[model samples]
Target: MEQVPLRKIIHIDMDAFYASVEQLDNPELKGKPVAVGGNEVRGVISAASYEARKFGVRSAMSGAQAARLCADLIFVKPNFDRYKEVSKQIRKIFHEYTDLVEPLSLDEAYLDVTENKKGNPSATLIAKEIRQKIFETTGLTASAGISVNKFVAKIASDFNKPNGQKTVNPDEVEAFIEVLDVKKFYGIGKVTAEKMYQLGIYTGTDLKSKSIEYLEEHFGNSGKAYYNLSRGISFSQVKPNREMKSIGAERTFFKNLSSEIYMEERLNNIAEEIERRIKKYKIAGKTVTLKIKYSDFTLQTRSKTLPYFISDKGLIFETAKELLYQEKLKDSVRLLGISLNNLNTHQKKFVVYQLKFEF
Candidate 1:
């Protein structure tokens, strides 16, 4: 059997994207603890600057709690339009090197530059050049990781953060993964890490000792993934033109309420936001899902699939309202959200190209 050559993958992640953009547009915000999204009264922090992070402020944290963590933290509204404009500029730089680019979000992406347009053989040099071009074009910093596959590349990207890059050579892949902490593995979350710890699997070496049957018995299907990933084996490809599965918006109120009237008003605002997002993407969905969270931390979702696709705010709110009253209130609600899926966007076929380069 002919041996397959190694691939050259790079993962690029912007540093504090939202907060950095805010600082770039307003110099006065530079060097200060800044947070984008929400107010002290309600909502959640979308992103926090490096300065804010030192005070334990983090994304998805409640605004009131973040304020308590950092006394002088400044809050700024998220400007998605501005962030999208910058993202476009950065993506143009990536396309200049390779067409195989997979955007994970507005702030990060994976690029397969094994056979790049530049004819560059060194993935490290390409990563360096790409980061430099991104900073030069958008006046923002980016970190990169270059390796033989996406999983290692994603982990290496965080080794040197805030405008830095790391490379894991093909020969070094196994050893690098062996010493890595299980918690730092890309797909393993806190809960899974705890389970691994209970089984005496604290690092890649420990995890590799377990048999596939043993892992599967404990973690179900994910055990197979952990077994392979621990040995530096990953078959995931970097797919370009990734489809958007869904678009949604939600809000956490400062106070919980049992009044259905107030919930209806909140649902209207969320629907308007969803409509704006769908229109911006030029897509409509046949499914509408309403998410409710109670004060006791219990969560529930109600969904309805329409016969026809719709993007109008009026239709979205009406559909969510119908789902809301479809069942009785279990407890006082603290958060409400609306999401649209089963989009009209065309799904692209995934094709895997054989690797032709080796380090």
Candidate 2:
């Protein structure tokens, strides 16, 4: 028996997730400009409602610019607990159709429905059902894109955001590629987009025209990636069941530091990075380990086990600092890493305790 190609990918993204949740809970916020993030002078916007977007407000924009864009813009800090609850709700909805779900962020995920729970094989129908369920359950709208591969599905979802969807059928992949802007392709960041524009590669057609050799000569290995994507030959699959692995971060310095104060400062940064990863996974761990690699290539590790799991940045930093202080390393350090282990799968219970203690 010939195996059927297993490629039914769909990308589902919430529309202004944080801002929409605020509006859903507060009726007065509807139709008004809302920005969800820190409002401090140095803070940047994390999510902007459609009303704010019309006035040039965007995620990562300075608070001052966002405020100037919409004098009526209201700022609301992100509530991680509530957001995590919503993410679980959406994930449960995804599980209704397929177990093959890969979450990219709290607001985005890719699902493979080649063989689905609902018994419907068409990716388009599965996306529709998922979007409808989200609106019915959370009072929020979602935009989805159905395509033959992860790359196309991801790009399709962004084409019509805010309660809309666009599908890219396998047969129409070529036309889709030809019409797409080079900047819109996946993996083409702002820096790469600018570089592509300078090289007269403004569209997918322009990118496709460049031979593999030409791209490799200029952009290295990534050049081959761009060449294939431009021809609508994206082969990336919808990866599933990606577990939350041990969270850690290591950084190398330009200069080896012998001073204790500077080493701790560097450790603080590494600790914060680990905390960010734990927060992203919505999980906490019970062990804190600090890794120090000396300038002479010698490595040292110090670990401490905590009574309770933690996801807070300050706690991780404190534990890592304690480990570093207790270690009797006399050599100068070149690199440092902070890591967490032993996840307490019961995330909500720990989260509540964390709020009471850490907050």
Candidate 3:
């Protein structure tokens, strides 16, 4: 049997990233309840500081609701360009250790440091150093979690916040997961957690007690994942420079449009954008997908796979039109998007050579 190497993974999450950045830039915002977004009735909060969180302010909550919760909540507009620059700096620091870094977002990432540049055997030490370096360089605090796999590492990262580190060793993996709440497991959202509670599976141990057949009968495909997670058996790797799964663009309108003509115009613009991105990336895809969002916030997607790969804007727009026309609109659409998938552009390019032999 082939031996599988025991990998060391680290998941790093910034401590209230946008909020922290806001506080870092302005001294006055420090030690105050801050939210990053417009403070309008319809505007939503992108992030909230720990102080604001105390008053139930949260990301994705309406500004009006946040205001009602916290009367003096401070709102700051997001600076995405500045955030991107900071993200680049953080990525640079990660690459100094290992290239096996998977960025989840601007604020979080997973790093596989099993064979790091520093020649360190201990993942714990590497995570510690990385956190320290990030703080020293970016004036931001990052929480680190080191474990044998990405799943546990991500959960452990949240164990300590605002600058902390935690390690779950190989020997302790089983015990560490057994007592954990089922809700804490990755992919187990609130709805699923409620279902789990109904089934009396509140912790890892309780989940492990249920037979695979029982889980499958209830959860379908997710049963396998839940079974594996209960045993600390996630096999997901820290993939670096993961190819773009799909290239797409979307737009949300201020008002819903019932006319197909206006939607087709929007589709043309979206297709043009997708084509430009495909050309820029030198990618050709066979699958085209059209996404529509109704005024009621319901989303629908229709897709078709062509016989051959294409990156042409005309074809993209036509295919999207075909998909859109195939199904009658259930309601007025507020958003339209176009995307391409099934790409093979990242394949290696090579020149074939013929060998001549003399006897």
- Among all candidates shown, the one with the greatest TM-score: 1
Clashing pairs in 1: none
Q: Per-residue CA lDDT of candidate 2, range 42-61, in tens?
A: 35578999999999899977
Cα deviation of 211, candidate 2, in Å: 0.8
TM-score of each: 0.90, 0.72, 0.82
Clash count, predicted structure 2: 0
Clashing pairs in 2: none
**Against the true structure, candidate 1 has what lDDT?**
0.92
Better of 1 and 3 by TM-score: 1
lDDT of 1 by residue, 1-359 (tens): 22333689999999999999999999999999999997787677999999999999999887888999999999999999999999999999999999999999999999999889999999999999999999899999999999988999999999999999999998899899999999999999999999889889999999998999999999999988898899888878788978888989998888997998999999999998998888889999999999998987688999999999999999999999999999999999989999998899897765445565564
* Residue 85 of model 1, lDDT score: 97
Question: At residue 109, what lDDT does model 1 achieve?
Answer: 98
Q: Which order, best to worst by TM-score?
A: 1, 3, 2
Error of 1 at 5 (Å): 7.3
Cα-based lDDT for every prediction = 0.92, 0.82, 0.87
Better of 2 and 3 by TM-score: 3
What's the best-to-worst order under lDDT? 1, 3, 2
Error of 1 at 219 (Å): 1.9
